[model samples]
Target: MSHSLQHEPAQGVTPTLRLRPDTGKPNVRLRKQSDGAYRRHPDEIKEDCLSQPSEQIKLDISVADYRVVSKRDSEDTVQRMRESMKDIPRSKRAAEVKCEIIQIIVMPQLVDMRYLQTATDDVIERAVEAHFVYSSIYLIPGLSLAASMCAAFHRDWSWNARGVYYRHYYSPHWITGDHTLWIPTIDHDMFDHPQERPRRERAQRLLRHALDNKRWTKSEYAWEADAWSDVFGQIRDDPALAADKRECYMNMAEVYPVSATLTGKSEMAKRIPDASIGLATFHPQHYQNAIASYELDSERLQALTLHRKTSLISDPRLGESDLVYPFLVYEAKGWSGDPRDARLQACAAGATYLDMLDALARHPGPSGKVEGAYQFAGSRSAQVFALTSFGSHWHIMVGYRRPRLKREHAGHPGMSKTVYLYQRVWSGLISDERKAWELLSLIDQIHEWGVTTFRDYVIRHLRSWHKFGRMVWKGDAERMRAVLGKDAATSGQFIIFSLPSWADGFGTDFKAELRQKSGRLMLKRLIDEQAGEPSITCVQGSCRARGYKCFSPEDFVRHCSSVHDNHSGESGRSVVKEVFDQAASDMKETLQELRANCYEIGPEADTSCAEQAWTMVHDNTCIESPTRYN
Candidate 1:
């Protein structure tokens, strides 16, 4: 038998079309007229509708345009324009270079303090203060003297001695020919004491012995002398060492001398120059004695003095003034043969040189002088010394630059360039080098630590640290979170997979229980939706086959069924049938009551009698009926 359904696109909307099975081909056909209306055949009814194309359409267009110009012509035009513009003048260029130098020197210090305060702890402030003290006591004087001595010694020393000094000092003085002056005191008592040998005495003895043996040839001396002179000239010219003269002299006693001079009363009366009278009171007895011996010594030493054309006076004041110029020259002479002495001399020179530089760099221009013309302002010079002892490296900052900027510029745009100064030990200090790099890398890692900008030095290192952390810790989420944060963990490209250990056991066999419970619940819902209706096969095979025989009291007595069961087959089919019959009867009564309630309460009232009937039947139903034998 075939059924036909009405097809109405306007009201019901037509279902999707399907091929007619009866026709035995992929063809759709309409059913015959039924109830005076044409309808679609059951086989032709569609489960899904065909989709139609959309009315809107998109269009695309490609466009082309061209322009022509001669390469040679354009080049000619550009060349002409370039030629018309003037190049920056040499003076302006020099000024810019100077300005840049000043900026580099000063700016970092001024800005770095605030950055340090924000990035780190109070250590920065303490470090700066300590640096100030170091500058005052060591760096300024050290570099100034070193510079002066380098210049003087390079000029005065033999070629061999100059080379030795250069090798010992690692001087940049070679590049900038400025000599600094320095005079170091040799304590008389220190040399005289018998308990312990003095290093200075040992060095002096070694040098004197070397010189006596003519160990250094004139050719070697000549070669070294030229090199030394060039280097010393650079040191002298260095702007930073301009103010270190006083400190260098004050520290060294040998640089100053005391002397006596005398004259006849008549000649002295005429020669009593204002300057001479000032010194007369200080040297009256010595001058008188010198006058008595002058004739004999003057004639004896006349040829030697004439050839040299120089005066040697043992006056402290004169020595102090004159010795300042030759301190570096003497130091170079001392450094030629002894490694220990060379090192000490270099250190002392470096300190004094740096001190002078600092003082000059910090010097406010000549009291109240103000001019628009640019001048070379001395900058801070720091010296880092590296000494290797017992296969270990030690580093010390032996010099510093003094702060020198106008109060207005102290907080100005150019202050950083003026105030910034530092010295680094590039090599020969392994542990310190490592630590410096590590700190720089740490700064890079944070990028903006609180408010401080990380330097390039830090950036280079931080990337490595990040890679290391990732490699070592691998998939540790907690650790990754602690180091980098939730965002970083997710941002990384790789995924890390992990599973819990299989040691935990469920108290019950949950898998089996869940399957069983789910199956039962599904079956119950299905049955309820069907309103207790049994399948046609089940009703015919199970219920009607047994019929009234199972329900008979005789069958129950014969079977010797238990009190819980009525006579059925061995599985008590009679009890199950009886329950089904009772459920049907109850359903009928519920429907009758619902109808009566509806009539009384008005037809609009929803009694929900069908729902109640299903609930009652479901609640009372058992999984299995009682067996007749049991």
Candidate 2:
């Protein structure tokens, strides 16, 4: 019977589309009975004939030929592997060279996702969509996402130092020409102060114990946590010191990477060091007290924060993120670690720290003085030290930037370029007892320099920068323009007045102006229109001193009255009239000059002179007055 699903006509009927099986066809087979053989047998063969393969042939390859083929394939694989290893370094160099100009797109959404542990494909797609939406909603002029097809590239100015295959390779040559520029010139006497003798002895004893134990050999962490910890204790303060104490100098291990502190061209691994030590952030009470001591308002605390944010004035970290005002850093390696790599890391970290101090000195304040107020070595030069260690050997290195020459005039030569140097000042082997004692003594001296010299230098410069900012903010319109340059036009609004010293403080009653000293001065009342509260300028004819502003009406009135005419009787009255006439004449001339300079003011003005003064004063925050430092 046929086994088709279709109905058949009958048992003997033939199908139209299907063929019948042929029973006489040949069956070719491979049989392995005792010996391997391929045979073609007749369709009707019996089981007894299976062992007698009448037509058969053996078909098999030798093991030696298989081995030869396998060896040939393996050699090809090895050759490819060899080629890949040789091309890897060349590929890296080519990539770095191509990145001479890097294009960066900083989307807030993508940045927020950086710390996420895991994310799905859909989540990433959503984040990208969010970034596009954000960019579309917050469009900035000249930076439109939709405007132009042209691509923008930001030049990697330090690209030379970024590539390992490049000649510079982020080494000392990139910073300074002479490798030995500062090494031989280090003042050895600076580390031998008499006050450090007691601590030196203590550090010596701790160092000896650390060296003899051999406990640190267990691991790199053991070296840092145990051996190094004990000696550093004598070099710094007790670990028990309150975090808020001003003199709470201590060591911190492995601070989180601060990308802001990276110097030169690259934001690479070298920017981070193993350890850092410096003054702890002062207690809020101490900060306020210091401000009070300087006779400044408590609100002035914002200046310090701003300074730290804009420049490396203090430690790169803001608020309460581990260490503050770090002056020393440690870069270490294990027993088998390469010393050169440690030194390079130290060089990068130290250069960044010193760069901050250099920034402050380079910023000539409103008084047009640079580094004139610094008390140690010289004002222009800044130096920060580091400790680079590999196993038992350690070196004390100093990163120094020479004092930049003051521009004799506006066009001085060699004033535009700055150089930085990294040099090893001292070295020691902890295994040697004498060298260990010397190392401990140097550590104490370095810490002393941090508290005394480093602290004072930072404080002094901060004072100068802050005081100069306040001076420019409150000074006359002329001085404001001089210091702020083009920013003075838009940063604030101003109006000039030639009112006599007796005009009762620009229309307001003298007593009222004094009573409301902290109040904002309105320019609309003076100009007889809806003018915004522009800064009020009162000029003194030919006085070289910065003229006063009506924002501080009390000071302006006292300045005009007392400074112009201090004599008694009719003679004083005559002198006052002459000064008043001269002031009026000077005011008219100054008004024309301001107009020519396009000092925009009036109803559309957004910031008033009083507002500008407050902002500038707060921006450059300092705890002490600059005069005290000078």
lDDT of each: 0.26, 0.41
Q: Give the TM-score of candidate 2.
A: 0.41
Q: Which portions of model 2 miss their true places by more than 4 Å?
A: 1-205, 212-216, 238-270, 279-284, 287-312, 318-325, 365-377, 402-419, 471-559, 566-630
lDDT of 2 by residue, 299-346 (tens): 232233222122223444321223445667787665545454565555
Q: Clashes in model 2: which pairs?
A: 303-621, 535-609
Put down candidate 1 lDDT per residue, 1-630, tens digits, no spaces. Answer: 977797457866766779656856656554322110011222322222112213211111111110012234456778985564447565676554332221111111211322342433244433432322221111111111222222322211211111111121222322122222111122345343564243333334333433332323333243234322322233333321211222222122111000000111111001100010001111223335522222112221221111111211211122122111111211222112222232334344443333332322231222124412211221212222211110111122222323332311232211121222122222121123232232222222222221111112222222332333322222133222222223432333211111111101222363334334333322332333222221111222233322212333344444344432344574555655565555445545554653454332212433353334323322332211111222
Q: Tell me the lDDT of model 2 at 10.
A: 82
lDDT score of model 2?
0.41
RMSD vs true structure, all candidates:
50.9, 30.9
Off by over 4 Å in 1: 1-223, 229-250, 253-336, 363-630
